[model samples]
Target: MMSTSFLHPCLRRMLSDRGGNFGIMTAIMAPVLLGAAGLAIDYSNMALSQRQLQESTDSAALAAATALASGKVADEAAAKTLAKDFVVGQMTNYAGTASASAIRNATNVDITTSTSSTSKSYSVTVATSYRLGLTPFMNLLGHSTIDISTTSSTTSGTSQTRSALSMELVLDQSGSMGYDTNTCAQYKKNGTTCKTYVVKIDALKQASASLFDALDKADPQHTLVRTGVISYSNGLLRDWTNKVTSVSAMDWGTTKSRDYVTTLSPDGGTDATEPMQLADDTIKKNANSTDAESVAHQKKGNSKVDRFIILMTDGEMTGNSNTWNKDKDQSVRDKCDAAKTDGITLFTVAFMAPDKGKSLLQYCASPGGNYYEAETMEKLVADFESIAQTATKAATLLTN
Candidate 1:
């Protein structure tokens, strides 16, 4: 690496060097390669921002639809306000390329209703378009900003058919979660400090908090949504068990799970079996009693209640060597199978993990959007929010 990297300096160095054509090429292409890499990073950031926008839109659409179905939104104007407000709130909570004011201004919401003899339906659409600023590399290329837009639609059927949900977040709080995801030196400050880097645990906490908030917007009364969190490193930290529910159906709402995640101090080796089993049991017990989760929804005439488990990990199962443990890995898979057999939906995330961990998460996932492999902290946050958005759409997703 050259200390002075201007083109003139590189040419001068290349000419005087006995390293010859190869060194000259290396010196010349070095800047171009670095510039190209920077541009790629900018494009990747743009992609993540757009994806976050889409997810926020999706959540907005669902929240508006739920409000309409629950009679909280009286008319089309109210629906629009609800949708815009929800999305703006989410964007405020989770920073994106587009500012909250910009996102709110660019967003559009449309609602249409249909009524049959015994049923009512409301179709809601949410869309947003904004200009995202790019990095200096893109500016040098004469592209300073990119226009991005996203749209999502949801339909709310009769209240009697809309289902409720009981969700559990099984998080891995192994020592690795305390590590940082900032790889490129260009994005760092002069001094290396705790405040300068993005830790994986902090990223999870933020993403999980956003997920809870979006769900709250969908079910403000907490009657239709109940979420819980349980983390395991070497095993479940006994001291933190009382803070969040491990084997309860109606324990988490907007703040309970967030509180637990916010205080997570990741340490020790990774052992995820115990918590995953507890989570599976806590939410799956609904099958015996028609789902205690569906009780409030049932009072509102709902008959279905879906169960979800969001399992996230940064490493494969651990053994004495602290690397891979096949038997324990299978045990986790067995728990996944048991939960899925009980009709529980699983959303698995492998964040900054090795191939073995990714493979394990892929196996635990329920196919399609259920599996997320986040190589960056930004993607991890987006993936968790996506999970929350997708879950709420179950009762309202329309194909026709």
Candidate 2:
């Protein structure tokens, strides 16, 4: 047996050793445990803040997009106001608070608008941001806050607007058409019973110029009208392609003139397929002549500011006579289909088409409103005027 004093000493030592180990363990675990808890809370808060920020930004972007779609030109003042409303509408103390700051900071807005006499549309973009407050753990980790951002865009177009209009004039020039003396006439009877005469070329130029003069002087409430001409007989004539095909496009800016009419000297073998191809090509090539407007148009399904095709022909597919071959016919049909594919409204005119070609011309135009044939100069001019007026009315109804 041990003496009481020695036993007390050993018992005391054992108790002290146990207490020391417990204290050491507690000291090591206190910071670690606290840090772990802080981390969990901080991460949770971060996630929540991020989700809310996304929602806020999304809503703000949508609001701006809606405004843009409403045809509001994204002028700077309008954009700023749009941003303000978007942010303030969603937050507490919207007009006066940090939420407002967040909203202002978040709003990155862009508005683009294009107008033709027949159509008009706009594009809007809104960007927003939100701040995530730092969690206690983050503070302890020497971080204060995190930021998040988001962006969205929308485009809208409307037709028949009073602001802008797009017009396409198609003219027919074929060699067989040269036998007439008047601007747009064909010999219906011998001199004893002759009516009137107007060569196809002369009549087209006069009608085109007159139409341009009328529309050029007319005013749309807030739109600009643009006209492009496609002169076809054998093949389509664009400035580039038509020039190469010996067709000329006079550069006319008379009365807000943009792109002018293509001049057809009547050289190609007539292929009813030409006008459709040229119209399709021009629409595809120029959504808007300018870049800023082009981007806006692209956003709206690459829609043209306004779309139109005027098919004026004197004869049928006589040249590429083979064009009527099933394969060639299909190809031409495909081109027509492509015009429809491009969302163009086609108009056809038969100045002096033979009975066979007349039927073909009628079939090629928009049913009920597009086919017109004239036998004399007076009729030809009257027909040109009628076609012009009708086309103008229809084009005026398209989006601007």
Candidate 3:
């Protein structure tokens, strides 16, 4: 309370001696500041590690469950091996290339697999310790590590299985399909230069082959997949007619559909109505057939058949043979609508098609994410593969 001027010189010297105050304060508060910084850094690392662990376990569990659902893994031991392999494979980013040793040292991994008459399930738990980077403060606190863990489970089998799929692929083989594109190579025929062109048909063949391969992979047992091929130009080709073949019965082990595609030669005009109607009729007949497969599926209480018509074309509808007074484009749309009304899902692809063709196909496709436009052959193939995977329900993700 006394004024500064009234204080004695010695008292003033003692009160104003602040040369070492900063060092004293730092010395006193250094541990708290460093401890806070260390906690922030270590906690961030722990969060990252936990996220990565969850991702790995989730992927492993889903993969193992899919294998079981598809009958790729026969028993519990095989399922466990698959899950562990997947988990270790996914954790490679965390442990470098030595993930095998990391997985071995992980004490918190528990894999449990169970199967019932109608379903199979895989549960995976991964718990491991991440050594904190040795910050001087954390080391001084004797806290040099943090633990991270995650658990994920997935189930699949007959109960979870989608109904048997009947996919009718209606591909366009018009004269434009024979036109040269850069996607395919031109070959010499009978010592002639064969025009040295890569036709759109060649791209279609390659893409169709890839699509069939994906379908084969999706249906390993082949009991749940049946495919019918219909190639159309001015009219539907009878060669690949109402012949619906099971995945197992195809010439190739799983890719027999490729044979039908490979044999097709393009040489006619474009018409969408005939091929669309043919595909629709084929799917309806097969879906409602009194065959053993349909009866068995009906008996299982899953009477809903998954019917799909994948119509791909490279040109506008030009002919009017099968249409009833409706324009070519309107006729195609009407058929597509009827097919949809009959519980058949439609996927329409416009590959290097004109604006008119693209618009018509867009109208024909199912409302939600069923229309695709591919300006290039590569994109066409990728789209087909994606559709095949979706149709077979091969890709599954864990939500929780």
Worst 10 residues of 3 by lDDT: 244-253
lDDT (10s digit) by residue, model 3, range 217-248: 76666656677677778766444665532112
lDDT of 1 by residue, 1-400 (tens): 7755568888988889775788889988876786798689988988888888888899999998888877787877888998998888877665653587888999999889998633678899999976777887766667888888999999986733346788898888888888887733234354554345777888888778778888988777666677878888865666554553332234635567777778787787777788888887777745456655555556655457788999999898894257688888898889899889878999999998999898988999997769998988778878988888899988544322
Give per-model TM-scores: 0.56, 0.45, 0.54
Model 3 CA lDDT for position 50:
74
Task: Report the CA-based lDDT of candidate 1 relative to the real structure.
Answer: 0.79
Top candidate when judged by TM-score against the true structure: 1
Clashes of each: 0, 32, 1
Instruction: Judge candidate 2 against the unseen true structure and give its global Cα lDDT, from 0 to 1.
Output: 0.58
- The alpha-carbon deviation from the true structure for residue 142 of candidate 2, after best TM-score superposition, in angstroms, is 83
lDDT of 3 at 174: 75
In order, what lDDT does every prediction score? 0.79, 0.58, 0.71
Name the lDDT value of residue 372 in candidate 3.
92
Pairwise lDDT winner, candidates 1 and 3 = 1
| Alpha carbon lDDT at 366, candidate 3 | 88
